[model samples]
Target: MNDHCNRCVGCTVQECRHHSDCEDFCTLDRVQIGTHEGNVTMDQCTDCKSFDRR
Candidate 1:
């Protein structure tokens, strides 16, 4: 991976519009992470609310 830009250490979400090709890193300054309201018990329940389409 290339240098970490913004706060992203690394990312594989190439579909995101803010994803950089150089390092496979997210260029966004920050990301919003959240969990579902009803019965959040596992890692699958968490979501990256800041993901935008390319």
Candidate 2:
């Protein structure tokens, strides 16, 4: 399954926009682009709750 809330190791809040009061908002586990065997992977922006799609 594709998870999008896994926390990253040594994530610095200074560069994060949600660092003020939402550290967990900028963390992800994995991102799924298509359905495939062992094709699931995590991305840098997937976990970020503050990730603006604009």
Candidate 3:
């Protein structure tokens, strides 16, 4: 993807397929965010449902 195409979607997970190859960002137009907990109260409860292993 072009620099601008995914630059706005900041990320740090190196294992995600959508993560930029050369930058700390995601290459998807939109990302799916979800939770694994019934009653979430911490950041760890959230997840990037859009994630796909590289």
The numbered model that scores best in lDDT is 3
- How would you encode candidate 3's per-residue C-alpha lDDT over 10-50 as one tens digit per residue? 89998977887788988899998999999999999999999
TM-score-wise, the better of 2 and 3 is 3
lDDT of 1 by residue, 1-54 (tens): 324466544677888777776766777778888987688888789877888888
Q: Write the per-residue lDDT of candidate 2 for residues 4-47, one digit (tens) a residue.
A: 33454334444643332344333444322333335446553234
> Candidate 2: which stretches are off by over 4 Å?
1-11, 21-38, 42-45, 52-54
TM-score for each of the candidates: 0.68, 0.21, 0.84
Model 2, backbone clash pairs (residues 3+ apart or across chains), number: 5
Write down the RMSD of all candidates, one decimal each: 3.4, 9.9, 2.1
Give the best candidate by TM-score.
3
lDDT (C-alpha, whole model) for all candidates: 0.73, 0.39, 0.84
Candidate order by decreasing lDDT = 3, 1, 2
Candidate order by decreasing TM-score: 3, 1, 2
Error of 1 at 14 (Å): 0.6
**lDDT score, candidate 2, position 41:** 62
lDDT of 2 at 9: 31
